[model samples]
Target: MIRRKGCSEKGRRSPIYRVAICEDEAPIREALLQMCRELLSQLAPEHQVEAFASARELAQALADGAPFDLLCLDILMEGQNGMEFAQKLREENERISILFITGSSQYLKDGYSVRPIQYLFKPVQREELEDALRTDLRLHHRPRTLTLRTGNKTTVLPIQDIRYLESQNHWVVVHMREGQQTFRSSLSEVERLLPPDQFCRSHNSYLVNMAWVAQTGRRELLLQDGSQVPVSRGYYESMQRQFVRFLNLK
Candidate 1:
């Protein structure tokens, strides 16, 4: 899953971030990464950052399970451009904030559809870069816990340990590494409780944890546990996108 791993940006305090820079030009790419490091050093002391020559490389790393809180993407390249790539990213997970870097103003109107946190133009000014990092978002990581109640007993489980959840008549069954647990609740209710960036509605009967998903097809999702879950026609593309966001995949 990893080609080469740099320093792990484990947040030493609250409001830590994971950031990436995807640019085709080496000079521009290094400049952006340097700016990020300088700003993050002041704003988020423990942020993890990475640089990529193309969008494809960044997408591959995400697929391999590297967590990125923010992605700094470029708009033009030899292959998949940043605007189209960002659109694809939106379909998966919607939590990672994006910052687009480009030399052209033509894509501005079109790029806004993906809702980037900010935009930095070519020859980016240090003041603007500083403002974007400092005054904008002070994003925080979500806690890895799932709280469920089944009658008189209540359970607070680690999110990483759970695989998926299935909804029956009036209850939801949680399938996890240990086994299964059931609680009287609707799938919607459970979905609301879980982090949107990590879970998705695979079908009307199922809510899946994106981390455990192995493979996906037009009609079903394969989980690490070797179980197949149906993917409703309405949610097919969206489900794939959600998995992409979850895995940070291509």
Candidate 2:
């Protein structure tokens, strides 16, 4: 719940983002949780965080009205692969930020379809995670509420509360301010639902909100929260021009 200056007037309600992590491996999951705790302690102590070992378990939790702003997911899992889980999650909702984690580069092609915020290799590094999270928080726009359906159940998600979105195959994972949820959808489709001015397609596989942008150079996009997102050659020029214009407007 780190409120930006000039965001509130006296007693006005302040905005809070939710973050979550879903990794099947215990060691990796613990590492992610520790990193989250460290980052939030320094960057956004008021934000809430939750952890899950599998998509099914996390999905079930989200059904209870949890708000997840960001999600860090591992590709391969015991019951359901991350991709399959993401598809089921995005099918029901499309407004949260998602970041994928895996040890293999082969997953990259499949990942792009989901339009994750970014993809990170396993053995999760603190610096990389921090950069991704911060960039996501800065760029999010037009906070709205979303309703998701799973089997006979429905879940309500508040957009402002989301920190980011992650892609797993045909599924997109929604990370909110309170808890994490997954859905079945593509990154392109999720982009359609987001506000263009706020969320920018920085890479073929990633879309980031401008507000979270801390700094940008010819080759990189830095998030205020301290994460660095790559500016691919294909998208570099267009993103640079658009970002420059965005700055000028502000």
Candidate 3:
């Protein structure tokens, strides 16, 4: 969803700006994709812009491990419409930016609930597109920081840097790319601080980041870093479902 661009690209953590344009009409879809390609080309040296004639195609691409930074959706389509797809994305992941393309202003009010960056009415304007693209770039490049206070020291860690969190008694250790930081906090308290779409509890003692989770076995969750996190019997189903959803997001 709101992945920090090239997370799994190149060697490791190489971020790329990716955009997905979903529109049923072929002409519009191609045109929109071209516009995005042209825009991103001017903005970044390396970028990918893809177009799908239907929402289903785009959804399938995402389900198949495609990384996308922003989604451009058309409200009306053949089967599953843009609104429906947007709602589904919200349920699965919350960080990806969404911009709706509709022919009328009537959908503007309805689109507010999805927290979209903006809407492009019929005959998309150059200025409007540029503004929305700029917003998208800012969100994708922004660093996600999380602050923790333990004893007399306070540590700030980027949310993406953290692979998972493990709690023991009243303290939780933040497992990150570099190393671990201990903080005086409960697992539930730490969970509350993170965005629900990105992290989930795999056990009473473990809070896992969906982004870095590589695989899930019968007894444990395997992270991309080759670390194993315990998964309790009661939390197994939830963790499995979360993992499936996480895969779908990529």
Candidate 4:
């Protein structure tokens, strides 16, 4: 595994970002792994990088609860090809970023279905690899955990698990798949803490997670949880544009 130090508070350590590389060719896999370690050391700072020789091995690791934020996949392989594995993987996960590396451009059109962040031709250049990695890092730069204080109690919530946030007067309600938590904070204050690309202002009183948005109408948005959030006339156009951009980027 590859590891590096990250920027953090005096008493807190940076959250670990997990990355995986799967390539059947040993020489190519080793070269890619080293490049990732070197690039991520400066780009992400704190991360865990793992390499796999086959798609099955990586899939098994995922089945055993391994978490990866980014995947570097080689197109042609011995048995199950990278494109097939990525298509299957997308059925279950829609957020993870994929970067495809191949020697031939024959399968370029097929790769678009899975919506990879970028594609690289083999004999990969360090500059091109760095560009793909930079895009992935920017998309996932939000803090993993959010600290909330209510009365005398303080709680930490995983940012990705949040579905949407509702503002009620002086208190904000944090909605999640598990339940809800009401905290004494302004919606604007919480919005400042979240990444702008991932979350958007649906209305003056509501902030919606773009990933949870299933449908959007002229006046409202339908979340994955089946709840509807209002979209004011002023924010509707911009919200739709941002949501479309988010979908394309994903």
State the weakest 10-residue window (summed lDDT) of model 4.
1-10
TM-score of 3: 0.53
Q: How do the predictions measure up, each by TM-score? A: 0.50, 0.52, 0.53, 0.54
lDDT of 3 by residue, 29-134 (tens): 8778888878766554357888898888999998897877789999988899899899998898766789999997767787888899988986787667866886
What local lDDT score does residue 179 receive in model 1, on the 0 to 100 scale?
Answer: 88
Q: Report the lDDT of model 3 for residue 178.
A: 86
Which ranges in model 4 have alpha carbons more than 4 Å from their true place?
Answer: 1-14, 144-250
**lDDT string, candidate 4, 131-153, tens digits:** 78767766654466777766667
lDDT of 2: 0.69
Worst 10 residues of 2 by lDDT: 1-10
lDDT of 4: 0.82
Candidate 4 C-alpha error for residue 53, in Å = 0.4
- The candidate, 1 or 2, that scores higher on lDDT is 1
Total backbone clashes of model 3? 5
lDDT of 3: 0.77
Candidate 2 lDDT tens digits, 1-250: 1112211223221245577789888888988888888886644534677889998888887788666767777888889878777767778766667889888887788877667889989777888887677667556523355455656676766555544565678876765545667877677766655544456667776666666788877677877666676677888887876677557545
Better of 1 and 2 by TM-score: 2
lDDT for position 173 in model 2? 76
Q: Candidate 4 clashing pairs?
A: none
Top candidate (TM-score)? 4
